[model samples]
Every structure is written in C-alpha cells, then in structure tokens.
Target: MNVLFLGKIQYALYRLVLAETPEAYLLQTHTLPSDLNFMPTLGNGHLGYTVFGDAIFMNGVYNGAGGNSKRARIPNWLNISAVVCDRFGCATDDDELSTTNDTLYEMDLRDGYFRYRKDYKKLGITLEQRSYPHKYFNRALVYEVVASRHATTARSNAPQFLKLSQHPGIASDAFEFVVLNNGSNAKGDYRVIRGRTQVLEFERFQPQPHEIYILFSQSLEEPLQIEWPTWQMEITHRIIICIDREQSVALKDLQDALELNFQDLHQKHIKRWHDFWDNDFSIRIAGNSLELWQIANAGIFYLASSLPSLTTNQKNEPFDGLSPTGLGRGNLEADYQGHSFWDTEIWMLPVVTQFGYDYAKEVLEYRSRKLEAAKYNAYAKGYKGARYPWESAYTGTEVTNPCCPEVAQQEIHISADISFALQKFFAQSADFDWTCDKAWPIAAEVAEFLVSRAACEELKQVCHFLNVMGPDEDHANVDDNVYTNAMAKIALEFAVWAGGMCGNASTELFEKWQQVSNRLLILRDVDLDYHPQHEGYKLNTEVKQADTILLGYPLRFDKSSTHLNDLKYYANATRESGPAMTWSMFAANYLRTSEDWRADEYFERGYKSYVRPEFKVWSETPIGYEGSANFLTGIGGFLQALIFGYGGLDFYRSGNQTTMENSGVLMPPNVEEVEINYIRYGDSKCRWIYKSHSSFMDCGYRKSGKKFEMLQGNKRTLLATNFNVTHRKGDPPIYINLMN
Candidate 1:
C-alpha cells in the first residue's frame, strides 16, 4: 500500500472501486483478535466508541473516574459492548470481516459514519451495520444493524440476537437491564435499556461521592424472538447509548434520545459535520495528493471531536477539557490517565482559536475554572500566585505519575505556557475587554509566580531560572532551559503590558517584571551566537526536540543570525522520535527565515511522521504510541506551518493599526502554487493564493465591523470597502498584492 494516499486513496485514485481495506488496518495489525489497540474509533467530542469488525468492543466517555479501584484513576468510563449472534449461539471472532469492498464496508468522512456488511454464505444470513456518534446530542451514540436473507432460496431457522453488553467494571454491583415496547408507535416500537454502576477516583482530591451510571438502549424497527423458524428478507435495529455520572441525568437523556427519530438524528449528524467543514478554515492544494487534503481535514475533525463543548458539565468532571490521549479507553494500565499537559495551551488552543472564538473562549474558561486549584497548588509548594500542574486532571491537581517527579515538580514552564496562551488569545482576538476581565488575572498571577521563581543576581544584572524542565522530557531537571526562560520573559512582559491596559498595573510588579524580562538569563554559548537548549547542553550535543528554536516561531523573538544558527544546530541534534510538534516548529522557523524550500520539506516530513497512516490523525509519536490520535498540539503546529509558515500570517498591533501582518506568500521553488481558502484569523476570513511570480491575499472581517489593514512585508495596504468589492455581510474581501 502506498503511504501518501492512505485514507482516501482508493476514492481518489479509482472511482469504480466500492471499498478498500482501511489504511489503519493495512499499516498496523493486531496479532491477537481481542487486542483493542488497532481498533477504529468514532466520537462526537464527548463520547468515543471503538469498532471491532461488526461489534463495538469498547465504548467510553470523558468522565473523571477510575476504572474499578481508587488508585487506578481512569478519566473515562468504558461502559458498553455489542456483538451479533444467530440462533445457533453467538458467532466467534473468526466470522469473516472485511472493509475493502465498498458495498461491504465504508467509512464516509463527509457524513461522519462507518458502515460494514458481512455475509455468512453457509448460514444463509447477511448482516450490515452502520454506526455514528450524534453531533448535536452530547450523550448519545447511534448504531444501526440490518440482517437480511442472503439469497431468494435462503431459508433458515437462525434468529439473530444483537447482544448488548453493559460492563462497567469489576468493583461495581449496581447493574440493571430492561426491555420496553411502545404501543403502536412506529418509530419507538421496541427498546431495551441497560444501566451499570462505576466509581470515580482522584489522586490528590476527594473521589466523586455519587455512583456513575452508564445507560444504553437498543431500539428496533422490527421485533424478533430468541428463535425464528421463518425470517423476513431484512430486519433493522437501532441502538443508542447515553452515559452520565448521575443516574437521573442518564435516564433523562436516554429518554430524550429515544424520542428522536433515527433518520433525523443521522441527518443532523451529517449536517453538523458539513457545517464544521464549511464554517471552519479549509485548505485546497492544487494536486492529486489526496493524503495532504485528507490529513488536514482529519486533523481539524479530530481536534474538534477531542474538545468538550461549553455545554458539558464541569462539576466532578476530570478537567472536562482536553486530554493528551483524548477520551480513549486503552488498556487499563496503558491509558493516558486523561491528563492535560502544557500541550493544551501551547500547541492545541492555537488551532482551536483559529477555527472559532467561542470554542477558544471555552478552553480558556476551563483554565479559569481551575484557577483556584492552581493557586492552592502554588501555595502548597510555597510559591506565589498560580503554578499550574505539569499533568493536570480533575481538580487541576498535580497528577503526574509518582515515578516522574521531575515532570511534576521541576517543569515550571507550565505556568508560563498558560500565560503565553492567554496572551496569544488576547493579541489575536483583540478583545481587550474580555482579556482584561477574564484572562489578565491569570496572566498577572502567572507573572507573580515567574518573578518569584526567578533569582535576580544583582551584581551580574541577570535573573536566572534554575533547575527547570523545558518541553524536552528527555532532559530532566536542567538549569536555564532556553525555552523556559524565553517563554517566561514573554509571560512577564505580557502581564505588565496587559495590567496597564486593564487599569490594574502594579508599580512594583511592573518594575520586577520589566527587570526580569530584560535580564532573563538565556543559556548561550561562549560566542553568544547560538543559544543552548539548556545550561551545559553544549557539552553533549544531544538535543531532545525543538527547544531553543522555539524562540523563533511561536515566541517570535530571536530573529537574528544567532537564531538561525541555533535552528541549524538543533535541526541536526534533535531526535527523530521526539514529539510530533518538533518538525513543524522547524518548518515554521525556516519559513520565518525565508528558507521556503527547507520549510516545505520539514512540513512534509512532519506531516508524514506525526500523522497516523489509517486515520490521518496525529498521535504522540510516528510509531503509533498510546497518545491522543487527534493530538491537537501537533495539529496546531502543522497548521502554523501552513498558515504562518507558508502564508506568512501573524497578528500584531502597531501605531493605531491592529491587523494581521503578512510577509507575503513564501512559496517553495519546487511547488508551482499554493492556496488556502477561508482561514479564520480573529474576526476575519482570509484567503491567500501564491504563484511562482506573484501572490494575492484577501481579508474579510464579519464581526469586528472594523476596517483592518494588511502589512505585506514593509508595505501596508488598506482593504477596499465591500461597496467597491465582493461583500460577505458588509465585510468586503480586501485584496492586496505582495509582488506588485
């Protein structure tokens, strides 16, 4: 199988082929039939379910809880499983399975549904299944199962039983199953509800006092007995699973879900997916490379699905935000523990911010909700202000594995990461009021912590941050990490700048922040041309990932030749197996330095290594480890490589002009053209078209109602008013030329 055309290859290359084996299965296979690691999963941001052949082996939701024991804290609940059986008894795992035939198995990316069909020729029975998670309904997953006669002469006494298994855990005893029939109601003729009990555990906080409930109901279009001497040509069944920590809520949601027509729900799900693709930013490269387009689309889909909407209940929720491994219920021990890391603010949130501001606001609000917990954590450690935990889960407590104390205790950059995200959101959105009201407080507190964390060497006129861990987890407990100090400097400066804007500037705090920002000790070599990853990093040239080079991209600091040398140095030293975001950082930095060819090369390399072969989603590592498949941080980095790197887009406010700054389209020499359509930058929608000789850019603002200028390199061009141009709600598409 070709690697470039993985997911949508068959569809792209040959229109006649109905189905092909999913790339996921072709690239990675499980030796054991029962291994859930290689299963395909579907979710609607809140609930996730894994599909194995025709059965759903594991179904779970993002709930803050342990599996069975208090010490084994599982932030998700693996609740239900479903399998098919005939009158002869349940079918074994060997029952033929294939997703290679279009008529047999199909995963519709546009419709957000998976369908599979299997034929038992000897048994004269055929089974088809279609499954999808409802986009609008947060609590429900829908599965449609069909059983039909294989041939006209196919006569059999085999009655199919769609076994719905409710397995909560080993420690819970509260389990109930019930079957109900709607009298004369065509849509809700027969239904079965299964409920199970579970427990929730927190490492440093009190466990949830209530019993968690997992409820699922199976509704059928036609009823069937345990045995049937005669069967119809086809019979259809619909199953819906509704999960909640509270039994009452689960029951209510289940009933509400049961009341909806199956066809309507499925249609709504399709529409939701379409709206996501239409409203959010989209990229259409001019090429037959289906992999590139599919990867980008899949990234957006995975990132959106992994995040919890604002409607989700936050109380007793396991950080109920975003997790490193998403809401997947992997092996009990191999689970990611549903913890949020610095990855959320630094890598993931930027992508979310670009797609929609409301979603971005919700992410920030989640952090705000945990502010008090962060403060308590800092105070407990005898630090001022708030110090976010390196691994934060429910209650925002430090939940890092006990064995990895360096990550939990010494990665002080987590605080700076939060501050940086807040500042980025503020600067990009230009919502000064919201920043002042909501984000500034957090930034101010983080600034306080940074000031306290830094030790000022008065004689040397430098503030040193010692014994800290940067993004590179390989190097632990290191001193003066360049990434840490650079981000810290930005955090402190933002706090002071935002404080004055909000009329809450502290004179002493400002002085301290300014002093630290100016004197922050960045570990540089003897020549002061290339910054080291950390102090003593020069001794052994084994850099873990993009540490010092980060100063050039997201930080947008060091733009000098020294920064270029550091980028070159780390480019050679960084490990290939480092985090997925590392390569994209290199791509972005190269783009900033006008090295278009290298930027494009690194972008392609990053996309190939970071993305999964089957789903085109990003995992932690290229080799498919136990991490979030949708890994938003890597997605954000990849997007930065495209939008910020090649498109040359950045946000800045200068001299009464608050607008997106562009360095024109930096097309690589190898590529003839590149185009990005409908990129959401703040309140505006931007489109860029670049060719070998010239580039065209258009910016349209829909909400701000403020006219913004585009700075192409050194030239500033005001977008023409909609009255004189194509208008989208009175916001005209402002066109500018970079090469003219």
Candidate 2:
C-alpha cells in the first residue's frame, strides 16, 4: 500500500495468496495458468489487459480488426469473465477462489487497480472485486462487485446471481447477448435498474474482417434477490469492448461505452491516472535500495503503459512503433509480429526521450511515416538512401522472421539506427524547424544509405562495413563491426552535422560525409589493447551483447585508455545469457570509468537478473523466459544506468551552447546516496542531487526562454533563465575531465 507522491515512494500494493487448487495454484505461480506469460498487465496505451485470475485477457486496437492476416497480425482476444450464483445451488468462481482461506489478491500500483476478495464462512457470504482499464473512457472497461450477507448466517431463502461473460477472440465465430430495459432509468435507483435488472449485450465476429462489441451494464435490477437476511449488495459493471472493422461501428462503440456515467467515468479514470503520474518524468532515490527504487519506479510505469499514443492500421496505417510484445497478446506459436526493432531507434528512443517529448515525437513520427517504406527498401535493394527495416510492421516492409534471413538481409545497422535516432532527435529537440521539416530529410536519406552501403576500398582508402549485424545478435555476417563501425561513424557525422543545421549543406554530400567519416572501419586489437567485437572478433571470446561496450557508452566513440581497454575487454566478453541490455551496458560503461565499484557491481547484477521475479517487471532473458515483458530495451537500459549512470548526466551540443555535463555524482560502494528526481533535459527539468562530498542541481525550464550550460566537475555554470546550482568538493570543477 505505500503509494506516495511528492514525498516520493510512488507505487506499491502487491499482496498475494492464492493456492487452493489449480495444481496448487500452478505450483505457487510465476506465470503459467495457461501462460499470458507471467501475467499481470494493464495498459492504457491503446488498450491492453491480462489478469487471468477470474479472467480479463483482452488486447486489441493496435492494428485492430483481426489485423490484415499474416495469421491476423496477432494481438487478439477480449475475454472478461465473472460468475457467482446461489439458490441452494452454491456457486462461486473467480478461478474458484481461495487465498488459502478468506481469499484476496491485489495489484494496485496506486490506482491503476485490480483487486479480488472472498469470504464465505458457511454461506454468510462476502465478495469484493474491482478492476480498471478506462483511463478516461478510451473505449471503457470497468468492473466492481460487492456482496455481503451475515445476519446470523443468512439463509432466509437465498437467491443471488451475478454472471457476466464475453469471449470475443480466437478469431470469433459469432455472439450476442442483451438485456436493456429503458424505463427512463439513469440511476433514479428504481431498485437500481428495475426488478433485479440486467442489461448485457455482446457481439463478435472475426476473420481479419474483424469485429467485437461487448457492452454489459449492471448495478442490480434483474431477478437478483436476497430477502433481507441482513443484506448488502452493490454492483457496477460497465464492460464495453468495441474493436471494429465496423460491425455497426462496433455496436456503436459498445453503446457509447455502456452509456457512460459510472461515477462520471470513474472520475475521468482517476484524472487520467493523475495525469499519468503527474506529468511524467519522475524518479526518487534515497538509497537502501528498495530493489533499486522498485526498478526505477517500475521503469517509468512500464514505459508509460507499454508505449501509448499512436494507433492506426487496418488501412488507416500509422503503426511502426511500439513492439517487443508491447501491445501484449503473444503466443500463437512464437509471435512478435507486432514489429519495429533496432530496438526502437536504439533502445526505446533514449528512455522515451526522457518522459515523452511528445512521446519522443511519436517515435520520430514513426520514422517519418516509414520514409516511403524506407525508400522502397532502398529501391528494391539496389540501395542509395533509406533502407530502414530490420523488422518493421504495418508496412515499413521487411517483417523479418522468415526464419531470420540473417536478420532480414544483414542488419545493416538499421539504417544507421534510424540515422542515430534522427540525430538524437535534432540534438535533443533544438527543433530547428522540426529538424528542417522532419529530421533532415531522414538524415539525408540516412547518409544516402551509409554511402551506398560502404565498401569503397580503392586500395585501402578504407570504408568497409561489410556483411553486418552488430548490436550483437551474436556475430551474424560480421566484419568491421565496432558497434557497426561506430554507428556508421555516427550516421555519417550526423549527416554532415544535420546538413549544416538545415540550411541543407551538401558539397557533394560533404565529401561523401568526410569519406564515410574518415574511412569508417574501426576494428583495433593491437594485441588486445581492445576494441574488436568484429573483424574476426579476436577468434571468439564470444559476447552476444554490448558490442564493444557500445563504443564507450552510447557511441561517445572511444576515449582514455581506449575507454578502459574496451571496458575491460568487453566486460568479461558478455554473455551471461546476454540481453537485458547487457548489464545495462555494463552499468553505463562502469559509470564512464569512474568505475563506482564497478558501477555498483553491474547495477546490482542488472537489477537482480533482469527484473521480473516478484514482478518488478523487465524480462528479456536472464531466466525470465524469451523476450518482451515491459522490456523497452531493458527499460531503456535501466534508464541508462540511472540517468546516464549514477546521475553523471550528459547532453551535448557545444558551439551554439546547450551543454549540461555534470560528471560528479557516483556513489556506488553499496550506494549510500543517489537521487535523480527528474530528468527531461531539452525543454528542461533536469534535477541531479547525490551526497558523499556534496552535489546539487536543478537545471530548470518547464517551458521558458530555453538556454543552458551547467557543466560541473570542471566549472561552467551559465543557465540563462531558470537555475539552482550547487557543487561542493571545492567547487571549481563542474565536468571537463571528458573521459580523460
């Protein structure tokens, strides 16, 4: 029950206890009651739900209508079950209740809701249930039930019933159920819907030409009796399923979400979950590791309920975004068809561009609406610009997995990782006319497909990149793969520095991007001095992750002792079942070499083995079963090991000054202190904090005349408008050891 806000904490309410059968509650559950693979999910991001104990399931809307067949583009189902009856018929089911004795099972992550309870005691009855998924009626889904009896063990001619069932998926066949009596009732009580009232309606039909419409309504009114043996009843079910390929507009949006008003749509779904946890960007760490502050506040609410905003398909297009099992519903024989990868522009758009810069500009506007299907997949492979697709979906072509054709034809650094996430979203939203009308023409067609897919060897003038696949999918078609030649030399020097900041500079494409960023090959081994996760990768030291310590942290491109000799030679050559963002990129390259106790022992061994145990949720290997479970690239590499590793925070752009550096905070010898508090940077919100030897920061700019500077460890400070600085360890050093 913790759940606090300004005074921190933010989430809690677990409480479990179910073992009364189903194979002793499926051997004390850890998922597998017919697997929704480690269940417990609820999403507002284009509808999602899982909860199994007494059924909930549901997952539609992304590519909605039986999704245009590739075996109906996955994500189906919309179950929702409930039942409890009596009249000497004694019935009770919510997966046959039994938290051993007086049943209970919760999961409330503060108001996202889900509860269940039971207590019979020789029929003196008691039941309680709650559910949610109507964050502001986006096609509604609410449930509430309550029953109590006990007037000295009530039995005065018992009569009770509360049944609700809607199945809608597995490619439906047909269905409909209704009970609506309109006697001018709008909660004028009339014994709540008149005479034990019941008004349920269902509709289903599937075949890619999909449709679903459930609409159930209740609050007691139809033949639901209990002749006062000390009664107390309360019901509230406002189902509404909807889906659509137009079955009469999915039965008029399930009768306008069962005629609204469930306490004003549950107070506008609790003020849209309190404006989604009070306007995003939040983190609070004080120390004694409560499992690293509940895995960094449940990895920012499972990446904001698994990537919300942006939904359209069945022809209205717009998808190519959230995947890695986001819109949930998987398993019809290993499905992940809900595509988009290169792990969403390099590990979930840098932790969703720090709390949504308009959801990281709708994931670069879904890669500028799939840049003309990535320029016709580089003009049917003749190549020369826009080749983005190591598994896109809803039409950005290359839907991979045709039995992994070398990651769909040699993972050509996913078009330079979508031109380095559109040059780090125009260098963190400086937004020069939307990076010259949408990301510098897709970063000049991804530097013209990495200069026509590299290779130009005119006798060692160098520019190889050969047979690629670097973000370690375990050495496939390798050669010169130092994190794909340092992200194709930072996407050809950020397409000649974003084509000279949008004036569209191109002196012969800036000398073919300075001869492919100075002969791009990058392999280096000089007798294990380091850097060689490619080009015969030093005869296999193995590594299926952090390809060369990601060139000294998110391609800072090598520094000091060659970034600590390739971060201690690939952090012991990776693979401890690699993936979970490989020890969060070896805890952000061991906190960029300050090595804070080896970055707090690989960030507590990558958060106690890739999260998911008592459900802190992360999963993408490390014994949490095959991929996806709120794994937005291992929660954006554990929020880049706590805001760029122990809050050292970075953020570039030097010439027209934007800086922000920090390089002070480290605290990892069993963390005695740490605080990030907030991090939005760029349209600022910064914050920092640390302790041992002092530190402080605020950066500020929740919208004002934006200007910044603050360096730290080597003194800078500048801030132009909103500020709050403080340094300490003899002040005059606010960040300039630039990885010396």
- The top-ranked prediction according to TM-score is 1
Q: Write the per-residue lDDT of candidate 1 for residues 274-295, one digit (tens) a residue.
A: 6665666555555555566667
- Tens digit per residue, CA lDDT, model 2, 16-116: 11122122011112233233455556665545555552222223222322222121322222344454556555455432332124355555453455566
TM-score versus the correct structure, for each prediction: 0.80, 0.35
Residue-level error in angstroms, candidate 1, position 123? 6.2
- Global lDDT of model 2: 0.59
Question: What's the lDDT for all of these models?
Answer: 0.62, 0.59
